[model samples]
Every structure is written in structure tokens, then in C-alpha cells.
Target: MGVEITSPNFKANAREALDDNSLQKALGLTVEKGFIKKRRLAADALPEFEALRDAARDIKNHTLDHLDLYIEAFEKKVVENGGHVHFAEDAAAARQIALDICRKAGARTVTKGKSMITEEVGLNDFLQENGIVPIETDLGEYIIQLRGEHPSHIIAPAIHVNKAQVEAEFRRVHTALPPDRDLREPESLLAEARGILRDRFLAADVGVTGANFCVAETGTTIIVTNEGNGDLTQTLPRVHVVFASIEKIVPTLEDASQILRVLARSATGQDMSVYTTFSTGPKRPEDPDGPEEFHVILLDNGRSALLGTPFQEMLRCIRCGACMNHCPVYQAIGGHAYGWVYPGPIGSVLTPAVIGIEQSMHLPSASTFCGRCEGVCPMRIPLPKLMRLWRDKAHDEKVVPTAQRFGLGLWVLLARRPKLYHLAMSVGMPLLAAFAGSRGRFRSLPFAGGWTRHRDLPAPQGRTFQQQWRARRFGR
Candidate 1:
């Protein structure tokens, strides 16, 4: 759980990810063919999907504008419901608050639903260090936990891992199981994981979960999951801890429902997730089963700082991961290359804001600006624009590499001199085309080894775009 800032080493990480054949196969199968196609079909089936996206975006925007008031209201409601609310200024404070709660409850083992906020704070290792065992009840989270790796994808944490890898990991970790167990199929593997996790779930003393939407009006925390693990993780334990960021608050249950209409369709291409659990507080005397103690931890962690800034739009993210699934760059290298709790398009913009641009300068430049991420985003967060803002900030701060800066400087100089630029391009194009005897692509090129090493670069067609435009326009 030494989830260090490897965003600085993004290029190297990307190279490694590209070379990993297994990772490539996983990306192709799970992302390109899986999420993308499913989401498209789901969106097409729902005529009001686009309108729903707009509503979701507006709902989040309203909450962000009056975030302070809504947070207070949410806290008040939780208190009225017999729940405790703790606000953490940062990741460290959040982790400490969680540990304190566990200690007070005498929790030796805690079961967890899928929680990115927990991962953001590195909670698993912290709990282990504090003599508490935190078990990931989410299938994807559990898989990565066994491998001792962070989530490579947001909703699908183990998307980078293939079925074969799971089989191997299950065999390696679940040594108590039969050596010849049939984990060749997805169902078989899921059954094996459930069997192993069922025991841990029952034995857990505390439960921790992330909030999908915290309804301020009712003081309710909603979690949407395909698997019913979240219900067990929260209900079976003596104490339940709800960890969420400040932006997750919604003004009312109606607003949450509006957003819910798009969340699953965007994330997993379902009309609705299999289980959408809502919890208000600890159990009552009349209740059948539930935790005895309920605690809510709200972590700011630089999010409050983004309130009025250009990056404020990023707070609208519901972690649906639609943007990432549609991102070309993400589909190519997978999420590990981004090297953070969040990955892909949203991560590209948010990581720098949370962690600082100087540390994550490469992330903004990771996109092709194809605009697919923005187009697919359920929140309508202008991801490409936000990424461009990061890039511009990086440039202004001189955080960009010297070579890139030099290239930009030269381009600026050329762009300002129309005649010189035209002359340079006209003279350079034919020479490049001449050098290419037959094949119209270069195997390698000066200052372009990165492109050529992986794939051929198409040679110039011996004419500048402007010249071609002139011919087509003027019939020269």
C-alpha cells in the first residue's frame, strides 16, 4: 500500500503498460469491447439519457455552489438519525478518524465495500499497521487486495487483471481450497471469492463504505452496487463507517434519484444496479438487523480549494468512469500509467488539482483531446478543457520539460512569421517525401522515435496543407 506519487514517472509507467501483453488483452476485451459497447447500447435504448445527463450536471452544480450549507444540513440530518459525523481536513485526518472509530469499537477486523476515498487515503495498510484487518468485500477490490496493488480502474478495479491472473491469485491466496478447483470460468471464480469472503464478512467487527450520494434532506447515504456485498459489509458489523468526500452531497432524495438514472448506465450499462442500498442510521429496536453505531467521515482533501476555481467542474464527478472507458489514451495504456487513486480523463484533470500540477504535469498532456471523455461524461464536466487548463498552468510555471518548452517556443516563433513558416513547410515537405522511396511511412524519424518505434509515421504527401487548400479553393 505504498501508493507513492508515480505520476512523475508516467512516461516510464506507460511504456511498461504498453509492453504488457496481458494488460493489453484486458484493456481490449474489457474496455474497448466491453464497457464502451454496452454503454452505447444502453444510452441508445434510453431516449432521455442526454436530458438526464444535463439534469445530473445541474444537480451537482447547484450542490457545489451551496456546498457548505448542504454539508451542514446533511450533518444535521445524520445527527437527527442517530449517526455521528466527523469532518477531516485532509487524507491523514480522515485515516486517523477512521482508526479512532475502529479502536473505540474494539474492531479487530473490518469489512469494506468499494470505497475510492479509502483508497485515496491508503486506509487498508494503515488499518493493518494499527492492528486492524480491513477486508475488501467488492469483488474487484478484493482481487487487487490479494495482489497487493492499487485499483487500475475506478469502478472496475481489477479490469487490468485477466481471468487467468485471477485464477492464479485465487490459487495462490486461497491455499485452503482444493488445488484442482475449477476457476477457469468467471462464475466459478466469483463463487470461490464469495465463499472465501463470506467467512470474513461474518467475522468482521466493523464495516466501512463509500457514499454514492449523501441525501441532505433525509440524512441518508446511498450506495449502488451490482454485487450485494455492500449490504452485508454494513449490516453484519457492529459499527458502520460511511466515508465520502464533500462533493457527494445532494440537496434531496429527488436529486439523487435523477443522478441515479444515469450512474449505472454510464458505469456498467445497466438500467439500474442490482442493489441500490440506502442507510439512514444505526439500527432501531424494531429493526431486524443493522449496525449498532453509525459514523460519517467527510474528507475535504483539497476539494474545498477547488470550489471557485476552473477545476470546480471536476467536483461534479460521480466516479461513474464513463469518461475513462471512452478515453482513447486510457484504452491504450490502461489506468496504472496514470499512477493514482483516480485514473484516465477525470484523473488527468483531478489528480493535478488534488496533488499539485508540478507533481503531475505529465497527466494533462496524456490526452489526445479527442473529446470523447467530455462527450461521454455523465456530469458533463468539461474534461478536455480542464486538462488544457492544467497544461497551460504547467507551461506558465515552467514545469514542462525543457525540450517541449523549446519546441513550443520555436512553434510560436514560426507561427508569428507566416512567410517563413510557409517557406519552411514547402521546402521541408517534398524533401521528406523524396527520402521515402516507396513506402509512404517512416520506420523511424528524427525527434519522433516515440511514434515510429511503436508504429510507422505517415510521410508527408509533398505538399503543405495551405498549398493544397489553395489548389482546391482556387483551382490552381
Candidate 2:
């Protein structure tokens, strides 16, 4: 499970993301407008949407407070239902456990449903290195798997890929198919992918999936999906394995329901996903179609250490993708720029917490501090506040660049002396305005080429607030 780290070079990643025309077009069409507009309409249609969000938040908070108890309860119930629950303290342990299970089952091929947890631990690569083939069954996942790319967005793994790119990938990988066949339309592409994966599903020895929620009251694992691929992936295989973080538990089915109400609306703008499958155990004696073995691998991977910290609130995330959908930075640069399993505002906070702030310090600086992410989050996570905490920690630990630290030092020095701050602003505004000429904007400016290079910087609209206040108060 050796995952490549590019978080240390986030500015470079973001610049590359911004310059890619194909990625930009895809982001503009699908991310910038599609999800945002649909979520708005869906939220507006439901009068209780906001109340549901609040309820979801409270449910997650309560479960996190008693996380150990619920996890124990869930494990007990799973045992009772004839399923095995394995606890892994870190990604390495989780990977080893999964490999052991696969080896014991004599598995040669594994079919996978969409699971970010598996991606976080680099399970597919690890399995491939060990002589097991893991196939992605989800359409988006299949596309990215063929392209050998990590997911660019949660819930929409191939969002960065356009139709033409997909068509090309299909032609390259699905060589057994007719070369002259038409795959110009998305429907045709889907049909071809479905035809190819159907055989893999039948031949699979193990299936891996992620749990949206693990219900403690009844010992259930739940997944919400728009497609039915998850059903086939789990039910058709001899061994079914779930890869999930410890934070994905709820006290009761009612609590899970409370969160589910807001999840689909926030994520895909649907009243509900097309399929919400619940798995409790291995195949029973009377069951016609189910896995012979059922296993749940709960990976902590630094999440347990965050329980009492300020970042603990991030555990409330339900992975709805709403924060990323509404995030301006994410919309501009997409998920790959954040260079992690989770992305956008939540990733900015969570990556630092899980992976260490030193390696991911640049992520927190990628935001514009816009509140849209928090506004749309169904779980009501205070994302910007969490990001600010990371930024402060980075600054305090000297993890940020020397130039940034120097700039902050200068600003802090200027801010402390009110008279000097006002005097500097008063003198600075007139000179800036005079240089702007009649355009009321500056196309080029010293120390602000970053802004002016992309778009003109509006000149100081008027005198500084302190000067206007002084004139009005003293008639100076």
C-alpha cells in the first residue's frame, strides 16, 4: 500500500489542474453547475431539509461521543449474525487482514464496489502486487481503473474525464470488442462496460465494498448507490468484505435513517438513491444468493487519536460530497489537486489530521475561506473553522514557507499598531488610485501580480474608511 504523495507540491498540482483544458471543461459542466443546481432544487423542494441536516449532525455527534460503545455493540451483533469483524489500527494492518482473508478463500479475482476506504489504503495495487486481480464494478470506477488514475471526485470518480476520453480508454482496454463499434454516446459506452463486467462478476471469488453506515442496534452494513453494481459485486462472490473507517457507525437504524434523508439530497440531489442495500451476515442456509463469508474490516488509521481534539468534529462527515460540490476552490481545481482520498474543504481538514500537518500544510492554504462548503454540508461540519485550525497549526509549527511566515509576521506587526496601520493605508490608497488612472482598475500592480495576471484588480473604490470617518467626524 505505497501511495504516492504530492500534497507537498499542492501549488504545482493546482496549477496543473487549472491549466488542463479537458479537466476544466469537465469540471465546468459537471461540477461547477450540475451538482450545485440540483442540490439547490432538491433542498428547496423539501421543507424539512434544514431540520434534517441539524438532526444528522446531532446523531453523528452523539455516536462519536459513544463511539467505542457503538463499535463494540456492532461487533457483538455481527458475531451473533455469523459475520466476522476485524479491527485494524492502521492502513498496513487493514491491508494485511484483507490479504489474509483473500488468501484463505483461495481467491484469484475480486470484484469491487466503489469504496474510498480501499483507495485510502491502496488495496487494489497491493492486491495486484500479490497476484490477485481486483476489478472495479462501478461505472465511474471502471473508467478510472482502466485509465490507471485515482478518483478525481468522491461519488463521481470519473468526473474529471469527458466522454471522448472515456471512449478512447474503452477502445484501448476493451480490445476484445469490435474496433468499428460505435461508442460515441454515453449509453453505448455503458452498455459495452456492462457487457464486459458481467463476466467478471460471475467469476469473482471475493467482493469488496464500503459501508455508508454500520448500525450498532442490528449489526448491519449499509451502502447507498444509484447503480445496482454493488448488489452484484457482493452477492455473486464467495467472500464479501467491507472496508470502512471506525467513524462510519450509528447507534440505531433510526439514526442511520436520519442521516440518509439528507445524504442523497446533498450528494446527488435525489430524494433517495436507487439502491440502499443492507447486509447483516453471511449467506444463511435458506438464502438463494448471498456471500458464503461475510467480513467487516474497521480501520482506525489515526481517526481514534482525533476523538477528543478540535478536529474530532470532522468525523461527523458522511461523505455526501456536498462540501466539495459547493466549494469554489474544489470547483476550480478539482479533487486531485488536494491529492488525497477525501478532497475539498473536508479534505483540507481531514488530510492534515490523518496524514500529519507537515506533509499536507499546503492543503489548508488552498482555500479562499468561503463559507459555501459549510453552508451545503448535510452534517453541518464547521469546515472553514477546522481549516483555520490547521492553518494556525501549520503557522505555529513553521510548516509553512518562510515567505508566507514573513508576510504574516509583517501583517501582524502592522495590525498591532492602529495609528501606523491607518497612516499607511491613508497614504497607500491615494497613490494606488492615482496610478490606476481613469480605468478604476489596475491591470498590473507591484506585489499583486498573482491577482492582476488573471484579472484586473479593482482600484481602491474610495478613500480609506478611517479617512472618511475622520472627515465626517471632525470636518478635516
Collision pairs in model 2: none
Name the top lDDT candidate: 1
What Cα-based lDDT does every candidate model obtain?
0.94, 0.92
lDDT of 1: 0.94
Q: Which 10 consecutive positions of candidate 1 have the poorest summed lDDT?
A: 1-10
Off by over 4 Å in 2: 433-441, 460-476
Output the lDDT of residue 251, model 1. 97
Candidate 2 residue-wise lDDT at 46? 97
What lDDT is reached at residue 169 by model 2? 96
Worst ten in a row by lDDT for model 2:
1-10
